[model samples]
Target: MVVHALHIRPSRPGAWLLGLLALLLMLPAKTPAVEGVEGELRGAHRWSGEVLLSGPVLLSEGASLEIAAGTRVRALAPESSLRVQGVLRVLGTAQAPVVFATPQGWHGLLFERPELPQILRHARFSGAAAAIHAQAAQLVLEAVVFEGCDLALKALREARLEIQGGRFEGNRVGVDLELKSFAEIRDVHFVDNAEAALLATGGCRLNISDCLFQGNGKALSLLQKISGTIHANRFVGNDGALVATRLGAGLDVSGNFFEGNRVALASNTFSQPLVVDNRFVKNETAIASDQFSTGEFRHNLFQGNQSALINTRRADPLVTRNVFERNQVAIFCDFASYPQVRENNFFGNQMAVKLGTYQSAAGARPPGAQREAQAGANGPGPAPTFAEERPLQDFVDVSANWWGADTDLLASLDEQGNSPIFFDRRDEAEVKSQDAFAAGGPIDWVRFRPWLIAPVADAGPR
Candidate 1:
């Protein structure tokens, strides 16, 4: 009986193996995917491929997980989180950033251990409730990209966060720091956030510098005893650039540039910030302080703004050595606001000092007007005791200032004809409030006399 035998010809030794490898190469490559990852990572792990998470994951204590560059982590379930209780080193390169994405909203990364000091660099997170949420944890995030998140990063309960060279765009709030936390955010770009780009409250300390904040609702808000320095930042096209609430002892904002914002710097509710050497250009109101706040605005440059400085609601601040050029109104005061304007240079301003509503020329006079009693006093009197009533303020002091190279034109003031330089009670008499409880009378009066012949040498930003 003859059996059919199949004969195959081989070209050379290992030729079949080469053919098999070629066939394998022709097939599609599937990246190794870890599906439905949850529960505890028991031991040290290094993930270099795609990982899909269905629920929450807990990195066990003492276990370390290192995600390599180009790793893609997708969350299938909503609100899923990676809780890092141990060391998690997600080291990604700029060319191959580790990605964490969710179509729905997820929790992103949560760090709870303070001693572990987890770090994530060159990572991208999107569609998260919070991209990084830490409580008393020490975290360092560098070159990260956060987008479409409700809140990009949050530090609570004494958490320490150091973020550098990241981009936070299209988020509700870029950073929320509270509960005595500490953060140093540097060289970051915060753009198109819905709410405040950076907010620090509850006695937190922040050191933010060299950042760019643009097209946001509010660039930065510091509330309730926030201390530290915000230096050399650029704020452009925001509704409000910086707002400080309450008082911080050593809050310094210096060397910043604000352009085209609605309000550049606002001090409210007794906030006393040391704002120095900043440049405000083309803003609606460069500096607006109100609600009994007292701040030191020194050596700032205000140019082409609608109102260079607006003081209202009993805000009493020291305005000195500032340069106001080509502004609509250099200083606008109303509602019992009292800003001591001295040593400033005002050039080409439409109205050097404007008094709106409740205003009068009670203190400011014509070229030959007479002075009043106690006019030499540069500041308001000390607050009366709790039992005694405070005395009424009769005049507002805006003396010792330089009003352009045409300083002598101020001497050619005509009461009936109007000077066209200042708008005060001379233009309209003080409007007394009809409401008995309202203590509004001539709070809008401004006195600009003892004027300087030429511009001050120490004016404008240092």
Candidate 2:
């Protein structure tokens, strides 16, 4: 009967197909951009093969967050690493110097912030493995320029580094403080490193100031346990500038300037150094200590070293008030280490003290049992002897001393009766007549003893 409900409009064909699908979803959906290279950047839900800028770019620990600087990051491979987590900020300067290179060579700057606070300034971190591998964060190297990085700043574990004015070159180890780190190097410039220009280990706590350890092999290598405070530094032409080993403890080497080093201050065994007011020149061995160590040489200023000061074998160490000049062998005690020589200020040294023989007279000391009562029997003896009344208590006042080169202060004496001695010399017009193989040489013992009062310039605890 009513075969004509032909006018059945259920809201006009579903409201005209829901208003044509809301005007085609408000019209605007066609994003597919990709261009980089002028201070590059990418990542807006990246996916054009998940956005990568050529070569090794596998950074997926929370996917995508690559920042750039004036941009020049080129590492086609060969230890490519820029792997960060979440954030990266490469802001550079000093004439725009942010360049982490490598297609065949160029390695530097690798931070893995485990604690945060990583900064790199005026960057130019060169040829890698290290120019910066500071894990456990808190690094702030300014004016960075570490070149040929084989190891030019690798502070691991609790790192808290803060190097300023850097320039470490040809590295093998120009700053490698491992575990428990706490470096604070200032005004850096360690050049030509083959081994150490600064290699502290384990219990590290360095604070080297005004640095310039040149031509390094060992400019400052304190292994095992280190503790430091080397000040106003400048150890040049190094072979072994300052090598404290084993249980190395608190070192406070002050006012440094050990020049032409071949061995400027080598302390082996369980060291406990405190060498003060340093300025040992022309080093061949300007203070070498072995045997079980413990040092405290004060007001240092030994000049022209050619094997000047080497205490061997053990005990009694604390040579005070130093200022030995023109050294050829200013102090060399062999086999039986006993060094408590006080009030030092010997001039023009050829051999100011070369005491030897602790065992040789067919091993003397048995004619009735007293070679000074068996050299006052105490630990460390038996074929390596010396220690005949050492423990020398303070004998200050080296009589108006200004002992600088005046030539021949006892030349050569090594078989035993240590000679070449010069007891006192307060101020012979601040001694500097200049002729230790002249030609304008030898006479700048702190500019002709400016006004002598240098027991480390206002002695410690200030």
Candidate 3:
């Protein structure tokens, strides 16, 4: 009965324990004999029942280690770990849950404490590569259960965590706040993560609330200096929900809901991103503004989306007071898209602003727009890789909103005095760009009058 140690029980009494329980019932129900441990474990220590970890085990710096509840702690191969720099406590509960497996894989849980104070409630980390790897640590994970991990918490440098009510499943990355790390993830439940179920970059400082992101491929991916406060999360069926590409300041994605996501809330190459009171439903695109990202999309609620805001290339957005309902095309405006759409509530939309053609401006030119264009002294082609010295607002600002229909047929407009809710470029010819318009010119007008004789009644979702 000796696998790694067999936990020393030399007593040979009662007929050698009934002939070693009939030779442990004919050997192999997947043999398991714990109690091994290795290297430095200074002052205090206490583990329960089975414990194997046969290689790396340094719990030094004024040492202390306590793990009880239902301790399993296996790992006798794959470079075993558990190197906490000082104290470590894994007081599991909730029906005795404390398992730290190693099914042919190991090396995890290396918390090099700086501010000390560690914790680990109701633990159950599996096959690690990083099931809990902090550096300047200060953990406090409760109700934990990261399964099949590759990285279920890899906080580096200024590490500080407080993850509550956890359950990250099939992790590839369920919490990887780097550099200036600081987390606050609450009521978590991220499931089926392959890439990002919370992957903040460098200057991290998150505070995600009431989380639930399901079937994830993205569910929150903030780059560079990601700042915080993503409240009331729920994102379902994700392929992408909540992207914040080039961040650097205090972020905020208020009261979220995002259903059936394909892209609910993206904001590439950042410049500003506030995105208020969210709710996007049945998404295929709710709020994407790529390349040159935009700010403040106030009081949201786009329902049944097919578009609900797509803005491409040099994307411009200040869309306020939202609530576009029954959308099929609420706002798509592609290349160099402009969007200052104001005070909203365009109900039952089938097409409340669509325009995209203009030949897609050579694939919407983003990603540094193929630089190396040296030809000008204001002459010939090339030269401008990045311009926009401020001015460019050539229309596409759907003024005061409230176009649900029939108010004398939207005050009778059409013929480019637009109010047929626009699809623009004078409704076809592939939406303008014959060198930017000619033949009876003057058309990119979606600047819907100072309209809104009713229904802005405090826009959507508060």
Worst 10 residues of 2 by lDDT: 438-447
The order by descending TM-score is: 1, 3, 2
Clashing pairs in 3: none
Flag regions of model 2 displaced more than 4 Å: 1-94, 98-110, 113-133, 136-154, 157-165, 168-176, 180-199, 203-211, 214-221, 225-241, 247-263, 270-285, 290-303, 312-325, 338-348, 356-462
Better of 1 and 3 by lDDT: 1
Clashes of each: 2, 9, 0
Lowest lDDT sum, 10 consecutive residues, model 3, at 435-444
Off by over 4 Å in 1: 1-31, 359-388, 414-418, 432-434, 439-444
Error of 2 at 114 (Å): 9.0
TM-score of each: 0.87, 0.34, 0.38
Using lDDT, rank the candidates from best to worst. Answer: 1, 3, 2
lDDT of 1 by residue, 120-208 (tens): 99999887888888999998899999998999898999999899998999999999999999999999999999998989899999899
- Kindly list the per-residue Cα lDDT of model 3 for residues 319-396, writing each as its tens digit: 888898888988887665676888888878888887676414332333443342323424677466433323434456
lDDT of 2 at 92: 69
